[model samples]
Target: MPAADWRMARFAPHRTAVSSAQVETVVARAVGIFGLVFAAQTVPVALEQSEALAVGAGTTLMALLYGGVVALAVASIGKVAVTGTAAAFAVLYAAALAAWPLLVDDPAALGGPPWLYYLANVATSAAAIAFPLAASVAYTVLVPAWYGVLRATAPGGQADTLLATLDALYAMILGFVVLIIITMLRQASRAVDGAQDAALRRYDVAARQHANEIERVRIDALVHDSVLTTLLSAAAAETPEEQRLAARMARDAVRRLDEAGASGPRTVESVGLTVLVRRIRAALTTFAAPFTVRVVNAAGVELTVEAIEAVYSATVQAMVNSLQHADEAGRTTRRELRVRGVGTGGVVVEVADNGRGFALQDVPNERLGLRVSIEERMAGAGGTAVVTSWPGEGTTVTIAWPAGVDGATT
Candidate 1:
């Protein structure tokens, strides 16, 4: 069969698309953006007025401090362990925000009470999705708290203590807002993945249940058409010759029961065309009328156990009917069974007999031997059976499997 049909037969399970990009990617990008923002805005402000911020603190130390944050971000971008590096950077960045005041060389570089610089850290910490919501909120609050402490304790910061406290509270509130928003999106993604997985599981369960129902129906039909027919024939015996025929029918019933038990629904597989034909011939040995079997253009093709059983049982029933009814005038009948492989991996078999045939429409629905036994049984196995007859020509029962049904699907 084609690749497309095979995929339709077997489907892959659901998986989360969110995991395609690792969580580390989010952390790296956030850190990279934060570092860029810091370098672009704060670096110039700190070094303005002829490197005023680096007066007491050497330019080398200030440059190294900014470079450190950038280095951590860059390091986390590579194949390094994500959670460890992110945690380490987040923890140390808190310290860096706290130590900014100590690194200020000129008093003028304290630049707006020195406490408000931590606002930028709040935004950066908010971007760290790897951190738990609580941890992120804590980091947001911690950065500002460190700034507040240093500013309140600094010599000239005593009068601006209230302003420093307000800055810290503002940063804490904004940090939590960012955390909640990101957390909600993450939860939504997880919920979507869960729903998709649940739906796929339900589909698998439904498919299994449907297959089981079909199997049950097929088994019931086989029992009705094959088993009951034999029993009826055995019960109707009248003479020594008839008794022998009935005994053969009884033995056929026993053999069919054994085959049914041995070839269980779960353990069966696709059988070779020749093997199936041989089995059919053996199955019909009990029939009083002899049937010649032939195979044509059927090399390297296979039939599903279900399809095989369906065709075999239905064809046997057809032959039995022909022997019993086709030659009502007491004339010799000729029976032919043909199996062929045609099209793309397709199977076609015909049970044709050279006997007086009856009109098709005259068969009643009450007699389920043809409809239920042959037609319904074949349909269940994903195949079709068609019967044609006339007053002069013999009846032909054709059984076929579609072009792409290569074998039984387990």
Candidate 2:
């Protein structure tokens, strides 16, 4: 198939696609709404059973803890604090359950089930959303069992064994249902995210290949039409005017050819370190963001022109990447460029940024700025590039020529 036709092929839109991060966010909001609704339902029961609770201390503590849960739920709905909110709900609900027996004025006066019983499902649901599978499952079983034990004891109105068992089972079942739903949604969303990332990586490789092919075709056409025409005109010239025209066309063709070869591979030739540094300094001025430059002991050092160009290009690409991505919220980022001579013949260039960084492995394979432009370019020129970064800490890109030498000055 023709490269142009393949490149033109349409890709289907992902109308129904969703990522794990997005699914998690939606689930968190839904759980928040669920908690709020359950809170409302528990209110009427609390009022009906107010006589059962010890007036001042018990009621005040309940209000304080439950109010905190309600605030967390509201924050979740607004997408402010999700993970922390889920955790707080689970912990606070457990505290309330443990304090239930002590808070009651008289267990015998509690003729019916406690109002807290109605919110058992709410507590377990919060646990399911907040904790890991093992912890959530344990909480589901333990909390219900504890409730059942309380029901069969004097402090919990001394209910029959069968009644307590039934109550525990019901709450456990509801908790399990919520756990299953959330687990399945997260698993499916992760699968979708993985598939989308793979697809994008494949597309990136194909697009790069297509661009190379197009450039090759353009260079081939230039050689054939312009170069061939100039040669033919020079051979056919008979008069001084014709000769001058042929000469002018020949010079124009040579200039065009030189432009074409500008991006091609070059033979190794020695160049002074000062020349490379000067070129980089000139390029740095073009960037809008400023970089702190440091140079040390690089006066007399010499390296192959191919290596010099590779290091220069890689350094520029690194600086460009920092400018594009190294941003931290609520803080200013510090960027630096360092160049120094190592050993007698080696050179090193480094670009560092104290900005919001990212895990190297997490970067998509198709991101040519690192994989192709910097790393691959350096490798092709017989040099090495190492990228080090951590999320939030910062990023540093170190480039070294002649492969294995490092004489980096602090």
Candidate 3:
């Protein structure tokens, strides 16, 4: 069987029980009404045959049974597990009906036609279907068969047989109608459940997206608080060196802010890598004095919006590091920032500074500018940023991000 069918089958017993209970409650009320009617008919017959022992005894028994069944059905309202009780009541009702004929002088003269008794029999038999499988089969088939045998020996045997056939047909039609109604109700319930499930899933997705956006905003706020404010304060420092350092830090923080503001590539379409590269190079020159930018094979490179933002941010960080730490203002003419397209697969952005470079090993562990902003950001964007620097030699910061052969970033 298919997986869904198997699952539904496993759940069917519980669903059946619930549905059966509902059916039983409705059927019970109907049966109670029928029982009341039957008991009432017995009243006049008992009055007319006041001295007949069999008639009086049968009338009393039927009245008591009908009253009891009515009480039981009323008490079991909204309860589905009363199938067995309902079945017992059905048996009692059938037994009472059979004995009722014997109570009157002429059973056919009691009320209506003899066919009415058959109609009542058919209605009672149809009520049996509300019970669980075993009880329903026993009451529906066996009780009717028992009645058939008893009726066969009666004086108006042909009439009883005809009534029985009509009742049987009525029972079948009633069963079919009940089945169709129940089926339609079940289908409607399932459709409502499916719609609710879909609505919940959509809510979950929206919640997750909102949480991500909030986190991004938080990160941006933290960057502004720690980096941007400090740089702005440093920019107003008395000494030129402190002012330059502050300016560089402020510029770094600003670039980070811009990148953060640009919703990740996941939220947008592709952007040209060449244009992003040129923009980064220009920003670096604007932020730091006398910075030389060289572009080699930077044409025809396109990347996802997020990847582009990541690459741009990393390039800006490299430039900021060169401007702040690289002591090349008095020694070298300018700092070199090279942008290159690596083969047909990726783009490599190299920021090399001829300054008093610090050893990579000597860099402090808590420095988040390189670790968090550069390396972590690149990694999240499915790329890597490498920083290679040693004392007395030039520092080279290279950021590599995936690029399609036709210059598209996935």
Candidate 4:
């Protein structure tokens, strides 16, 4: 992939230009804000009927219901308290309905539909937002049916049976509409979230493959232009001067090879640790397996090109080593990467895994992965790598530059 496209995939924006989470937030806020309006409309009716109901019961019911509405409205700005407040109001409204008869001193004194009628939709709407689909559906149906029953009774102003049934149908229709909209929005948002996650995973894999191909090309070029040329020059050497020159060429090739192993394509520039941290994080995402990552105060440190190359290469190698070797029969391994800034301007990266480890001393000389790729690579760039491992415990590779005074760990 082109750099631009890869970067676009890295962030994984939704295709519709609006994320599902954002849509859900908008819905929540809309419901919450509209709930406030409904609560405001009920205040006058509540005040008018206060004398007909028990003082304490009516006061407590109104206070809790209004308080829950206020909380829902405040939480509309974020997700923190929306569900809790919404659920509370849904139940509180139902309680107020059930107690309406007992609280009222005389049902005959009530002159209109009653303050509870104004809030019927509000409660069901809250339930739609907070409860599961089945529960919300039930609330949508039952709240209206209960209200219709109350409306047909003496306390509900003794309305005609047909009129009460119409009122119940109207409330149910509105409640179901709200419930359907919320459920659909939630389902759509969840789908968007899943797509973004899958897109990011694919991007990670593609990026890693691209990086590996680039490294392969670099190695092939070095073998053809540097290593092979040195070999041909040595074979053709006849005189002392020719032999000495071939030997010098061979030495130069080895140094170049070491430099190649130590870092990426050569550069004399420096970069902040923050950029290095980002690269490491991006690299980690490419792995099909999972691992915990912790970064602490790694932003401010400055590193020369050589040091950055060494640290990055060694850190990545450490993780690769863990992936390849950290496993046990019938046991799951846990791996972690921690990057942090140390005293003054130094940086440290630690890769650890709890797996079936081997004694460091048992590693054979032919296996240069640890000795050459990581340890010597760091040393060539004026850094250090300390690898610790023991049988049955785990392995930890700590790579540090400007060699350490231990830094903070996350």
Candidate 5:
């Protein structure tokens, strides 16, 4: 498309259709283009009513209205940056407007009927606002003053001083109306743009905060699953076999802590669900209590790094809780870790043991092992952890990430 059409097109006002920046630019362009079109009306008026263009140099005088119209028409390409073209046009227009009267009959003779007054003011209305606000204000006022002086001083128009002054004032008011409306719109657009930028900054801060919280939950669960679990297992050990298992737990805890401290946080990465569960089941063999692992339709399941880590840590913590707390002194500890698909694109994991169990409400908050390591950790990752236990029946801890939840394992 032509530059002029492109500039005018910028003013299309559909807010949903265009960006905020474009919406404001289009509004500004509309105002400028309207002023230019309003001024063009004077071209025909000059042709029908003015004798100044029929005098010795009248044809050239006639060309001022025509040239000014052309300049304003080109200037309506408002959206594009056209600094050089506009500057050249402004210079040529001023020179042409100023020379119009010099070529008229008896240039120094007393003014009569204020020749070309409306035509000149209309052209000024179109171009004068390209200046700074203060300059435009001065011109909007001065153009009328020039018209008043020219007409009021004319011997033939001397008796119509009041009419000449009113005419000048009328033209000035019309020009300022355009300036005022556009000024308000530009200020409003800037305010809206500023608000949009602020909202985006807040959103970024929130996203970062959410990520940090998830990281904290994962680390807390890891400590419960590894370091704390090892200490408790060492405390519960009676047989030499149990003692050896405790020693291994200590070694694993030491290595975990050493590696964690030596290296900064590792980036979260995807893990296969079946592979993760199998690893956990293999690790459980070292414990005094035996655990049976079952995978039901959970093969080939994939989950996000954070989801997998959170679930893995919490599940391990649950199994540790059972080994350390569930078994009675003279009873066989039979434990099961089951992972199964429970809903549409969802999974349910349970750590169950047949041993002495306590009431869920009786468990104190001081036990961060269950609250933070499992429940709170799951919640942070948009999942749930439920601990159900009675005085006699075994404790069952279920962790689930339901279908349609954000960041769910798929």
Candidate 6:
């Protein structure tokens, strides 16, 4: 495995602890099953070897010792101590196999229990399979090869040939199983790395979208609170002088908006309502005729970002609508655009004209300029759009929204 793959495999349990625990449980169960197999074979073989009772006893003792180690490994599950204990068991089993001939002089005459050797071989093979990489390979390969050669060279009895053949088969099978396990672990490691990479990409996309939305809200708020508010306030002014001043402010606002283009909204740390309104009004005045704007009651009100954007968009749409549908025959040089801040937490903006107006009921659904631009903007801010007009009396488009619906203002 590559270094990166190895590192990820080593630390995978930390990322998902529950999955790690489950894997440990599975390994423990496998170890326990191997121990049971060893015990069943060893106990029966011990009874059959009467002439070599000492050898049988010694083999039984070795089996019991290794069996205890396997039990401890399963009981602890995933501890470093399990590895140490398994290593010790592997050493003892290998030593017992090496000394088997000396312990049992003539096994064929006494129906030489080759089952004991087979049991020992299987137990040791399982230990090799369970141990970590380098260690598992070392034990599985070296011990079996050494025993096969020694037994072939000095056969103790008639059953020695059968024992040697079984040992060789066990060694080959164990080696193959280990290779398969390592291959599976490598594949699992790659899969985990791919999943993590995909997750990171999704997070990046979400973060960008969130940032864009925040910026849009900020710009909308600045335009509504400052420019649109001033335009609406000036429309309702009782004096000609106040009206003229408001008109100039609105003109300047339009100019600025055109220059800013659609760079999208930007969030600001702090904004003064009065100053922002002045800039907006100035920008609006620069737009063409039939697009009049008036700001009313904008003096002493505070608003959240979302509400401000809602009002700005609605007012802009209303002005655009008037400019588009205004009748030139009636000499309605400018449309009446009124934006009013009502109560402590709401705003009402109306755009009307003295020109010919269409029937509201007959308006086509495809004409969503007004629907999406005006109605949808307010609706998003938890507000509504009210339209009241006749064929002769012209049209009045009003948008209202409650303040503080978006989020807390700082």
Model 3 per-residue lDDT tens digits across residues 223-282: 779676876688578898888877777777778767765644242234345546645755
Better candidate by lDDT, 3 or 4:
4
Q: Show where candidate 1 strays beyond 4 Å.
A: 1-31, 49-80, 109-119, 122-130, 152-159, 210-410
Writing each residue's lDDT as its tens digit, candidate 1 over 317-363 gives 88877777787576677888888877425688788987888887998
Candidate achieving the largest lDDT: 4
Q: Which 10 successive residues of model 3 have the least lDDT summed?
A: 13-22
Q: Which candidate wins on TM-score? A: 4
List runs of model 4 lying over 4 Å from the truth.
1-20, 233-410
Where is model 2 poorest over a 10-residue stretch in terms of lDDT?
7-16
Candidate 6 lDDT over 253-316, as tens digits, reads: 8876765554543322111122224434544686677355566565444444455556666777
For candidate 3, give the lDDT of residue 71. Answer: 55
For candidate 5, the 10 contiguous residues with the lowest summed lDDT are 12-21
**For every model in order, what is the number of clashing pairs?**
0, 0, 5, 0, 2, 32
Model 1 error, position 31 (Å): 5.3
Clashes of 2: 0
* Per-residue error (Å), model 4, residue 25: 2.6
**3 or 6, greater by TM-score:** 6
lDDT of 2 at 94: 79
For 1-410, candidate 4 gives per-residue lDDT tens digits of 77697556445532332355466568778878888898898898887777778767668878888888888878866566677878888998898898788888877667787788877887888898789899999999998999999889888878999999999999999998988888888888667656644554464455557656767799899989999999999999999999999999999999989888766533233445755675677688988668798776654466655677678889888888888889888999999998888754688888999999999889999888899989988877677889889999999988888664474221
lDDT of each: 0.62, 0.78, 0.58, 0.79, 0.61, 0.58
Write down the TM-score of every candidate. 0.42, 0.60, 0.35, 0.61, 0.41, 0.40
Candidate 4 positional error at 135, Å? 1.2
lDDT of 2 by residue, 1-410 (tens): 57465534523222334655457768777776776777788776676566777877456755865676687677666656667777787788778778888888877767777767777777777787779999999999999988898888776768899999999899989988988998999899767766754554464455546556766888889989998998999999999999999999999999998887666533333545755676688788999989999887675577765677689889999999999999867989999999989865799888999999999989999999999999988887778999989999889999998888774221
Compare candidates 4 and 6 on lDDT and give the better one: 4
Model 4, position 184: C-alpha lDDT score = 86
